[model samples]
Target chain A: MRDNGAMQHSARRDDTAAQPSRMQSAVFLPIGDEGRAELVERRIAEAITGGLIPAGERLPSESALARSLRVAPVTVREALVALRDRGLIVTRRGRNGGSFVADSADPAQFTAKRLGAMSRVALRDLGAHYSAITRACVGLAAARADASEVARIRQRLANADAADEKAWRRAADEAQTEIAALSQSARLTREQMRLQAEFSPFLGLIGQDASAREQQRRAVLAVLDALERGDADAAASAVDAFVRDSVALLIDHQMRLHRA
Target chain B: MKALQATDAPAAVDTVTAFFQRGVDALGEGTRELAADVASARAEGPLTRAKLDAIVLPYAQALFDRAGVTVYGAGFIAAIGLLNDASGHLSWWQGPRHSKLELAAQNIGKEHIDYSELEWYRVPVSTGKPHIAGPHVDYLCSDEYTITVAYPVFVGGEFIGVHGMDVLLDAVEGELLPLLSGETEEITVINAVGRVLVSTNPHRATGDPVRDAGDTLTRYECEGLPLAVLVS
Candidate 1:
């Protein structure tokens, strides 16, 4: 009877282990380059957030991750790098130490530092640079943008128009970045993304007036219309004009505050 | 002695006119060569840094020589391939004239003359049209102005560039006006669009809209003139 009980207990433990392992495998089926990295990092982060991988729980070895995911060790490394950048995982060198979820992470510090950097940059100069780049992108987009790209831009613009000031600013940032990406110039897109990151904090500080924001929405729509019409020159001009006007408004407001 | 001096004045005038005509002719030839050189050079790609320098330095030197005439300044187009893409390269150059030309043009659109102001479109050597010296003349000469010449560089009937020169009233007032036998007529050379390209009178000069009203004096003169010479 005792031997029978021992067998039953061992079988129950095996079943308990098999269920989560199977669920995890199902949750993370690595696909392509970006998809694989995203899946691993997302799974790891969610596990930590949900206390599934509790603080101080050592993550699986890189080799083990590779074996389980049927992906290369390099992908595991990339996913770890992303999680490290986010401050969710800490790695140490020693016999006992591997990667472990951090016990505490302060999101407030991350946000404050990001915002403070933005506040220091002059909005007017940012506007000018933004204008120059976006104009170039719009011109290029008119020539090369595919149907899916057009739909994405239209969707972003709609989101921007319907959003409140804060939401609009964020949506505007994404839309501009998307437009730059549509140009298919990696260098241009990288530079624009950097600019957007630099501007984010100050964008949160200043509120765009409703009328001006509405006008900007209209201008973006006009650009989309030009794109739809397949008028490259007009699209370029419209984008350039919108950038100039938006920059002017930002500069005017900043100057007024300075004078007062 | 009186007859000798009178004859000398007409002879001097003829000589000056001949010299100007020769300079204009030489400019035309040089411009054609430059355009051909530009087209060939830009065919493969934009003129390289060394080649662009090679072209512009000599062209600018020639422009400065022409500006040395009674006219205060001259500017020409220099095409450089700055933007290159799948569509190939587009290149052009403009003016190497006085730096103040930019400042003077900027003063026109404003209510008050802001001395510190600088306008990008006004820059003397800037590639865009309504070249600086033309606008400068318009600001300085009013409705009583006359004679603005924009000698554009054409190669094979296409306007590849321009060499703008103006003869304003102020420059002529102290010297040439007294010599004319008839009443001093206001001759304004306007571009096809009616923007005063150049004028002898200071008031009708800079930034003033072209008046196409019933007034025959300023009724868009010079329709028959070459489009290359008209300033608007």
Candidate 2:
């Protein structure tokens, strides 16, 4: 296991909280067996929408991405082509040129498309995976996070304007990611952040609904309160409930959009 | 030798230390020379990106080429990062099947990349000392575990920025393993922060904390480098 000291990738208080790809391995985990261009496209699209590889940051070279993902370089080229076509990434040439995530990526645009395409099972599966990692992470935080650090996170939990999609998403992201960093296990924290990126597009949609945002805010605070009280099980359950509620909301949203 | 005793540390591992000393010394040598080159270029005119690239690119790529496959394996010392606000980050890296290094889009995008916040960039600027940050993921290009050796560049006493090389962890393991392998005692090489860089012991992988054996182990300092060999 990588020590937490070795895991400090950013100068930020929550190293996992950065938009840039601080933990490339976690975000760029290999795509084993599935070599389809669409799968590659989907993987990168999620990373782009989720903010693992933030806007304006250059992507790894095609060959490098292929090597890490264990796919053909041509496959990566194809994926890049798709992402470029969708206006998610733009590629340039010359000394300081490569494919960069576009400067203004509306995560809502990507999420709306994704939710419509995803089957109910896929949505639930993603939720289950994310909830499992977040639960483990928060439980560890409750057990290991020092009181001062926990308090610092508590202070930073901004009161997000629920009606503003961007404001609510940003606040939710910062709160959840900083709390995950408190786990003090760099690997777990990085993994949780990456999964959060994949989960963000769906979560971003919930910010438009005031009640949904309030529910998420309370669930996150409940987890934080549990952590402060040193109740590992309570923190885990709180996050589980949070994920379950969000996934159900997303599925319902997806159905309504399809019906309309 | 005096420094080792002054710190009340263990013996100096000449052989092991020399290996890193050579690499770091070479990396430092380039930046020093580049600093002089930049100073002269300024004397002639303004230091434009083109002007800087004309001098920096060829030299940095040559350094990568000279490092060769033996020490670096598949992961040659990655592109040399020339970072400063004026110059931004200009990387000269080995592209796919390329003979010499060429400028690659290793954070070439002009927006959203805050180079100021990275430890490798932060430490040298803060202390004016060469810093090695590693056993962390490479956010620049490759997604592998990496070690970045960075040195500050000063032009006419003005802190311009830094020039550094990102060395892959596996390449590091390959370089140090031969001398360290097959030891009866556990001999692990750790970075300045006490994270294992490489180890003769199979269990202690890179990034694992070096556990002190409580008087059972002797710590040997690697002169002039932020590294030590722990023997138990």
Candidate 3:
């Protein structure tokens, strides 16, 4: 009877793929030895713009952030002040208060600036990193997930209209993440989600074009088709191409946006 | 000699049973305390998230501390049907020094799954009995091979959810290996799902299905739990 309302998450059976701490992904990753407050500010700013930390979401306590990022509490404090000045994060003092990403964040507002600032080399590197993780996740999903699971996610993806980029991005993100979960490795799924949060904002800027959104929709569907067929290589390759195409498109868009 | 072995078997199984029962009762005590808090607080007014967290978080922390190394993960999976939020309200916490689980969180790129299908959540809610589930990979939470002991939480007659602890497979083997030692013949312990918990046979392996034993083994069911000691 319980199965009547059951989620189709049983695809994670390979047993070799356990992985991620929710907080430790991108936001909690250690900063460099530079020890500069600006670097700390920039690191957290990327997480916010990337939407890894959602608007109104409370950040780790100053001490907690300091310990995880391996920076001094004063450095973290300095970064928070800068983030507040930039209107990226806000601090409230109370029993429940801590730093929170400002609710006014439109994601696109922060992402445009972030995308323009990145060198094409850094952009390609980001895409390659995301694709490598996605390839593994899709390959595992193909080997472990049932056709029904893939079909359920495909149905969600198929229903999202490319014209409505926001809704499409939301559906696309949910679809890809659910498919990644089929890898049954908590770490892979966690990284996949983190990368999506970190990468989707750029995709959002690029996806503003109708053609770009349509192209991405087709690529996602192709990957799903291969996954449903239980062809791991086919599924993995489809995702690689999907990511390759988006990254290339994003690089072009960035150059075009800032044309001299 | 046969009569002596028959009595010895029950005594041996009882020791293993008592060991698991003590852990179950520890988790159950917290469930009852939280359920009482919820029921009484609801009697006064509406269920606020702050109030719920105040009731649930302490119990979660205590369960984590009290169970110590035995429990790798601990918390409450609120029956959203009772709580009336399809999105879910989970107060689960896990270790390597306490992190909240996002299995039920609604985030971009993250889907909130209906956990009712999972045996650990399903059995206790359906049977209204405490249950011991798995030696399987926990994709939803710990991402480890886990043996989950769950006690159903009920507020008056309404089922609130489950208060539970996850013992990692390594720790489970640690607890079971000594209890299962010195057997005259090969023996395997399997969970409710028939996944081997521990076995003396090198080839059988933990998580091997009991059905694969191929009629060569004799199965003795552990009293009240979905566990068995199989001798071949």
Better of 1 and 3 by TM-score: 3
Task: Please give, for every candidate in the order listed, the TM-score of chain B alone compared with the true chain B.
Answer: 0.41, 0.77, 0.85
lDDT score of residue B195 within candidate 2: 69
The C-alpha stretches of model 1 lying farther than 4 A from their native spots are: A1-260, B1-26, B36-46, B67-182, B198-205, B216-232
Per-prediction TM-score, please?
Answer: 0.31, 0.61, 0.66
Clashing pairs in 3: A17-A185, A19-A186, A19-A187, A20-A187
Per-residue lDDT over B128-205 for candidate 2, one digit per residue giving the tens place of the 0 to 100 score: 888777555543344345677778788767877677666677777787677655467777787765668887778876
The pairs that clash in candidate 2 are: none
DockQ of 3: 0.08
Please give the distance, in angstroms, between residue B124's alpha carbon in candidate 1 and its true position after superposition.
Answer: 18
* lDDT at residue B46 of model 3 (Cα atoms): 68
Question: lDDT by residue for model 1 over A200-256, one digit each (tens)?
Answer: 433433334667667666776787777766577887787768756755554554555
The docking category that best describes candidate 2 is incorrect
Model 3 chain A poorest ten-residue lDDT run: A6-15
Residue B129 lDDT in candidate 2 = 84
Task: At residue A78, give the lDDT of candidate 3.
Answer: 95
Candidate with maximal TM-score: 3
